[model samples]
Target: MKRAEQVTFGGGGLDRAAHLRGDRGALATAWADPAAAVLLVWQGKPLSTRSGRGSSPDQLVMIRPDHPLAASHRENCIFLGLAPTGAPQFACDISSWQPDALDQAMLASFADASEQQHPDLPTGQVFTELRRMMAFLTPLEAELAATANAVLSWHKSHQFCACCGQPSQVAQAGWQRNCAACNTSHFPRTDPVVIMLITHGDQVLLGRSPGWPVGMYSLLAGFVEPGETLEAAVRREVLEEAGVKVGAVTYLSSQPWPFPMSLMFGCAGIALGRELTIDHSEIEDALWISRADMMTVFAGDHPGIRPTRKGSIAHFLLQNWLADTLD
Candidate 1:
């Protein structure tokens, strides 16, 4: 796990200026700085330059703070942090702006392939699904995009105070919400999920959800329940989903999955036995695949199995396991 942080959405050395979160004076100066830039998010998607056909990678589009679109949505801005060059970085949600002729069906789909273009924004820049572009973005851009999406999603869902049943207001530069009625402060939440790589001998366990694509399969995963440790979660999830007993669980790496704010904890576990009694309610199918067959799956030659999606912790763990680099 030495290279654990190399996972997608891992730490990219972004200076999240937490000390300045409550300093209104410092925030004002940073906002007014000429080098300040704002990243735009629309309905959970981040604005990005489309990837080119050649060697160029898709990039997060950071526009000037004074831009008309950003200025109009200034109240919705969240102070992300400072860039390496000391420029202030912020994220603004322009989800209120509706694109012309937008396809509502596609937008509501599980895999939203549509890219939205604002009439006022620069040409070639569109709000694209983060899952579609995550692997193509730089490490720093991936981190920033994940942070912005998670925090904004939190704001959208937690508009009311749980303590006093009153509306809450944004505070601490979008990192905190304060309720005046009860004087309670709430922070963004990241649910922890344990995705296990369960192995016995040379074979690994994988399962596919009911509606997943025919050949798509991945490591078994589940949310960590209250009062449960990561190791316990892994064992419990594998047992519940596939009826496989796991032992000697060890942490591997983690990825920030911002499809609504989740931190996926990738772990390796030894299967006590190979027998599987798949709980049909939890998964459509479960099987044990040997290393050789997994290699075939990764190479796209296996007719029955498909590789896990790139940028996911499961993909990273499996790739490393194949290369014997999961140290």
Candidate 2:
């Protein structure tokens, strides 16, 4: 887990500049600087620079400050404030709104000189695949993209007061939505998920969810229910999925998974039993394989197993486990 932060969007020590976000004057000053860049998101998809030919894919909804909606909605977005190297960062999601300037030309328009694709331009798609195809994003890009999606999504859903039917107002520098009628405040949410790598001697257990592609198997994972500790979540999830009792669960690492806001807690557990009676309700299939078998999977030699998805914490943990560093 030494390279815990190495995953793309994992940890780059971006400046964040939390203290400055509340200062209206400073925030306006940073945005006015022409060098300041925005991470573009439309319905949770981060904008990226395009590669390859195919008429360039139409991705992202972005425009300059002169645009009409810029004033009304931009304040609802989070100002990540600054990157570690001193560049400013911002995030905005333009999903539902119609930007007058959007067109095929946008697919070729590069953002901030970084060569990363922003999103799948066309409609009727979730942001999942677009995120997967990205190789990486600059620290500024990552910060802007994360902030925009997190804040905008919160605003879109929480326009009304939870305590009363009255409307709310944006507060906390776009970080909180407060209801004047009921005096209730709401903030963005991140769900907790426990992803575990269960190992016994040289063999490991993996499971395929109901809808995954063929050969796709990953570390067993589930949400951490109320009142459950991380270790208890690991033990219970493994047992519930594969019928494998686990002991001595140890935390490995965590990743911010922003597909609708999730924090993945990665852990390793001591496997107490090998016989897997998979709960079909939680997983489609579960298997235990030796180190030699995994080597084949990693090498593309296993006909039935595929390598883990790139940039996933599951892949990161498995790579460390293979290198004998999980201890």
Candidate 3:
């Protein structure tokens, strides 16, 4: 758990100038500066680039202020944090743009970014889903993408005020939304979810949701309910979905899972009993997976099971458990 932040998207030291976000003059200066760079996002995907031949190392597609797409959506540009070295960064959503067929094809290719082409930007750039390319991205790239997707998605969905039935305006460099009708302010929200690595003896509890692909199972997870502690949430979720009692829940690590903004609280727990009584409504199936069988699943040799995808907190926790590194 101590080394948990060392996971992907975990160790980036980006300086998020929270205090300066409310200053209009400072944000304008940063936006107009030549050194300021923007990451393009379209429909929750970030623009990434790859070099010739092989796609071993991929980079985020960063554009200058004067780029054609930089100002395409005047209201969609949100100020992301500054880089470690003090370069200003922003995320611009171009989801409204209509790309041609070729651009669409390039955007869909998760692997081999070398062959992608974008008509709206320079060569060697294509917008792809962050979840697909997260493992290939650097720590900084992962953090930026996660932040951008979460904040932008919030803006897109929360255009109205919850206090009053009036529309809200974005403020604080896209960090806050204010409604004039009721004088109410709203901040970006991150729903807390508890994903547990529950163990009984040598086996761990894994479950599959109803809509997940066949053979895909992950650590049991559920949203934290109102006024509930994280530890309590972990125990409640495991029991609710898998009908297994949990004891001594320990916090493992945290991840910014920005698929519409959620903070994943990774935890490890001890299952009080191993009897399987799955709630078919919450999870399609639940079973205990031995450490040996999990090894095969992670190794791509399992005949009927595939481990959780890389770059997810579930995968991170399971991998550490296998190596006996969950300290």
Number of the predicted model whose TM-score against the real structure is largest = 1
What TM-score does candidate 3 get on C-alpha atoms?
A: 0.92
TM per candidate: 0.97, 0.82, 0.92
lDDT of model 3, residue 57: 65
**Candidate 2 C-alpha lDDT tens digits along 153-244:** 67777888878978998876677788988789888777899999899999999999986778899999999999999999999999998999
Q: How many clashes (backbone N, Cα, C below 3 Å) per candidate? A: 1, 8, 0
Q: Relative to the true structure, how large is the alpha-carbon lDDT of every model? A: 0.91, 0.70, 0.84
lDDT of 1: 0.91
* Candidate 3 clashing pairs, residues 3+ apart or interchain: none
**Lowest-sum lDDT 10-residue window in model 2:** 109-118
| Model 2 lDDT on a 0 to 1 scale | 0.70
lDDT per residue for candidate 3 within 152-174, as digits (tens), equals 99988999999887999988888
lDDT tens readout by residue for model 1, 1-327: 988999989877779999999999998899899999899999999999874335787789999988998888777689999878898999999988888889999887766889888989878899998877888877888999999999999999999999988999999999999999999999999999999999999999999997676799999999999999999999999999999999899999999999989999999999999999999999999999999999999999999899998888899999999988999
Q: Which has the better TM-score: candidate 2, or candidate 3?
A: 3
Candidate 2 error regions (>4 Å):
51-72, 97-130, 138-140
Best by lDDT: 1
* Pairs with backbone N, CA or C atoms under 3 Å apart (clashes), candidate 2: 46-118, 47-118, 48-116, 48-117, 48-118, 49-116, 49-117, 58-121
Model 3 Cα RMSD, 1 decimal: 3.1
lDDT of 3 at 257: 90
* Candidate 1, residue 75: lDDT: 71
